[model samples]
Target chain A: MDKLPVNHMQLDRLVLDWMAEVRTYILKEIQRPIIVNTKSNMRDLVTNLDQNVEKIYIEKIKQYDPNAQILSEEGFGDEITDLTGPVWIIDPIDGTMNFIKQRDEYASMLAYFYDGQAQGAWIMDVVKNEIVHGGPFQKVWLNQNLMEPPVERSLEQSLLSFSGIHLLYDHFQYQTMARAALGYRVYGSAGISFIRLLKGQLGGFTSVLKPWDFAAGLILCQALGLQVKTLDGQTVNVLSSNVILAAQSLVATDIKMLTNTSSNL
Target chain B: MDKLPVNHMQLDRLVLDWMAEVRTYILKEIQRPIIVNTKSNMRDLVTNLDQNVEKIYIEKIKQYDPNAQILSEEGFGDEITDLTGPVWIIDPIDGTMNFIKQRDEYASMLAYFYDGQAQGAWIMDVVKNEIVHGGPFQKVWLNQNLMEPPVERSLEQSLLSFSGIHLLYDHFQYQTMARAALGYRVYGSAGISFIRLLKGQLGGFTSVLKPWDFAAGLILCQALGLQVKTLDGQTVNVLSSNVILAAQSLVATDIKMLTNTSSNL
Candidate 1:
């Protein structure tokens, strides 16, 4: 393991304090007029609120750990190629489109890694004013309460969250998987999707996601003994964008079996 | 016009007070165990709370208007083929699956029609504790404040609410319609979809709906200058199940053009 200036508990406390401040700023800022700009396309969006939140997190991280490497959605963080030392990943606002349009169902996320392994993670449901946070060093929590492990159920009896684009275009046999499940929901936010999974409201979720979008959620899901894998049933890389799947082990097995059979034909 | 025992304002006050009682009952009942059962299939659920709420509305309606007819989801109200006299439509819990599993995004809706014309309507977003109510007799209101008309935008610049079953099965050229919008969301409840449309968060919604499901929303949408029609661009009959499309006039025109072109091809 890489050596760090502060211990895991100390780093965790610092992150919690920053999140509280960030949440207050977001709630206040949304009441005022916001400036929005498109990123890769009209469907993809970024807002001034996203940038300001990212800047707040980066400044605080730099002050506490001057040498900490950072990877983030906005360009304010470092250009990171490796996760060899103490690293922090930030998604200032995980669902920017939802933030700009609906003003709800968005989240702020942060994950800490040491020697390419997760040390701690935090995800805040900004509108609801609650956070689900923890990692390997400490058990997971929803705000001040301890989070219990989600109950596992069969795919035939659970609600699955599949990408709306994939369902419409029939990519990766998503339509077949959806038919096998009890029902389908599309929330348009990965952070909110993970929150539902952690609460056992959803059996599984599959979507194309970036590193910052999945980093904090991946850590929280793993700590709860949920399976985190690529679409082809392989482990997920912490630094690259891929089609990610997170669910209970049984549900994952069922999804893979159903999708593979349809693809074979 | 058919004569009635009471005027529109008196009936509206009675429904509003009943909704407040129903909200308190549901919030408290959910804290305890709920009895859930299948209606049409495993995916179509009805709970004890749903039945109880429907009974509450039925009793109150009968007490207030002794000869009033009711069309309801849970079979607690009267059955009539014609809409000649005073008729009340009630959907005790609009999204029963969401209520049983997610504990949010469901609603209780009621509409009053006399001589086949809407007098008033009310939909309560139970969790949020806010109600959107109004009709031809009066303008729309969100809680205590009057609602402003939603801004009209073209299909390419707006978000849409669509049924997941239709998207997965490729019914009615839904995939084409979804592609034309800024994005797609599926919340699984017509009442919630209507609330989003009323708030201008969604530009349009399309789904297969029963009378109780669309009655309240249709009245409120029409009061706000939205177009409510069948998939083929015909006016909706307020008494039967149909594939309904509710949207701003510009977005509706674009959706109809896109779907018509694809179906012809």
Candidate 2:
């Protein structure tokens, strides 16, 4: 087994302090005017606040470790093509649409990678002022409290969360998956949806997610024993956009079976 | 205009106080073992806590008005076939499925009817300690603050909230309804979804709702000038289960046109 790094505790403390500052800025910025712009498509939204938040993370991370490599959503970090030593991944505002529309149900996510392996992760539930952060070396903490590992839930008994467009369009046979589960819901925010899974309140959450979208969630799921994979049952690659399914083991199996059956049909 | 009831303010005050008591009981009961059972189907759930909560409302309402009739999800309520004088409609736990499954998104709802008219309504977003309550003659208050009337939204710019099952099944042409809007969401709780509409956070909410599911929402929608009708655009009968579509006026018109166009094809 790999040992916890000698400086891991210190680094984690610094990240939490930086997050405190980032959160304070976000809480203030939300009250000000939000300037929204679309990327990729009209439905894919970004805001001045997203850029501003990312800048904070970049500045703070650089201040903490000048040699650390960073990857982020708003282009504030290194444009590295591969995960390397002492790498930081940040999604400064994971649910910009929710932030723009509801001013709630959004989060800030960060993850730490070393030598192509995840070492630490953080997801801040911005509205609720709760944080889920930990890594392979530490028990996950939801804010200051230690979070228990999620209990396994079967597909038949648990609610699944998926994007509305994906299920509506029957992407990956999600419509049939919804019917097989207890039910399905979509909050339109990946970070909020992931919180439901971390809390064991959801069976699964499937989405086409970018690196930052799935980075922190992947790390947390690893520590919690939840399954994380591409919808086709391949392991998720942290450096690329993939169709991700995060779920308890049994639910993942059921989803795979449903997908296989649909494909055969 | 119907004159504001001579004792409407006083009655509203009484109901709010009753809600506070009910909220306290719920906050405590959530920590206890929730005794759950299914109704109608496995997906349709009811809990012992739901029954216990309804009994409190029954006892309190009967104590306050001996002649007042009630229709509720639990059998604790009166079995009146018609909307009569001094009738109370209650769904002690509006999102019983969510409550039993997720625990945070559920609410307790109460509505008042007199002489076949929706007179007053209250929906307690239990976990948030927020109450959305009002009637034909009074302004709706979210928590202690008065809520402004919802702004009208066009179909092209607004997010609609509909049940996932309905949209997946092509019920009422919901698939086309989703495609026309900016997007759609399903929180799986009618009262919570209605709260989103009341706040102008969502353009509409559609579902096949029971009388208890929609009675309070109907009263609030009337007060706020939002449209509430069946999918075929008929007025909702408070005494009967119906397929309801509640939305801003212009959005409703857009949906009607879309539904009309799809049927034509």
Candidate 3:
């Protein structure tokens, strides 16, 4: 392996510290009223906290690694066409609707990439105070404990999760795949859903997700020996939104067979 | 109103204490493996904790009010065809599938009825150590704090939840309702879903629920002045499973108009 410019261990520690600070800020801020606004549609919500958290991350990342390119949900970071250098991706509030309405089941996700490859990632269930973080080169950790690679389970014996909108709209035959699984669940947050997937609680998860939404989770899922790919069995482009499937290899294949499609999203 | 057989306050205290004990047991037992079995189908699951929790409630109910008719899931309680006496309804583990799979989002519920009238009801989010309890004669309480009644919102402005099966199978046009709402969520547990509803987090919730599943929630929802009824706008029978809807009155009416049905379930 080639030596990297920045110390990986030092960067990891710094990112973890940033995550802790962000978590504390969110916990205290949400106790009071928040400014909420919609993005593309009524269902796509963004909160003041989301912008604040993204700013915090961007500030910290620039302070530490000034040359790092950034891609973020709230658009607080740089806009580079390619990930040719150190890149930080952020989804300050992955399940903004849940945060604004249910006040739970939302997450903050961040991923570090160098030369278009994952270096480290973190997905924090802010309300639960649990963080699942790691990368392809390191063992995943849930909070302070080492997380085991999830055991592979057949689609028939595993619970599946889908974006509720996709399922309701019958996107890519999501309803059909849902019926084929042992059961279906919708948590509405890609980061939280990824936490469940990494914990072996979900057999598979399928949804149309943006870059920041899936970036952190994709790293953690890959570290856990899970397959992360597009519905058409292609590599997901981290710069664009895609209908993605993250699951055990066997379960992913089963879902593909059930859907039988080619890049529908 | 007529006087009840048992002192409501004292019984409430006793049940609260019992809930604490049950919560502790569940937290401990789930750390290790327990027996898992299926009930009506592969999706309908029951674990040892379910049976044990039901037995705990039954033994305590019998000890205090021996003549009380018990209607419970898991068959640990008495066989009762009518809610004519001092009746206790228990859903030991309301989201057994989630408990067995996700290890979260499940709840334990108990409701008391005197002469078919609700006296008190409790729904405990066991993992979170929070409980929502109260009845028609008393203000609803979420743990130590008094819970305010939920504010009414229109279907388009509120998040809706439904049974995953119903949504996937398009039962009663759940898909249409989902599209009409601000968003859709599926937590897969009636108790957890009811907790969200009572907290004013959800616009509405619709599901096919058995007696035990709806018993405790029905009381809490009614106490909060939210409407609880069948799809056909009939009173929900406390002794049988039915397709039930619980929501703000306006939201409920809106849903009924959308479905335009007459007791299909």
A241 Cα displacement, candidate 2 (Å)? 0.6
Say which candidate scores most in DockQ.
3
Model 3 stretches with alpha carbons more than 4 Å out: A261-265, B261-265
The candidates' DockQ values read: 0.67, 0.78, 0.80
- lDDT by residue (tens digit), candidate 2, B111-183: 9988887778998888878789987777888877888877787897788999878888988889898988888
The 0-to-1 C-alpha lDDT of every candidate, in the order given, reads 0.89, 0.87, 0.89
Q: Write the per-residue lDDT of candidate 2 for residues A1-265, one digit (tens) a residue.
A: 4464436666778889988999999999889988999888878888998999899899888887788899999887888887767889989998776787678788999999888887899999888888888887876888888888777778999999998889889888889899999998988888888888998889899999999999999999878888899999998888999999999999999999888988899
- Residue A158 of candidate 3: its Cα lDDT? 89
Clash count for each candidate, listed in order shown:
0, 0, 0
Q: Mind giving the per-residue lDDT tens digits that candidate 1 earns over A171-214? A: 87788888999888988889999988988889899998889999
- Comparing chain B with the reference, what is the TM-score for each candidate? 0.96, 0.97, 0.96
Instruction: DockQ for candidate 2, please give it.
Output: 0.78
lDDT score, candidate 1, position A158: 80
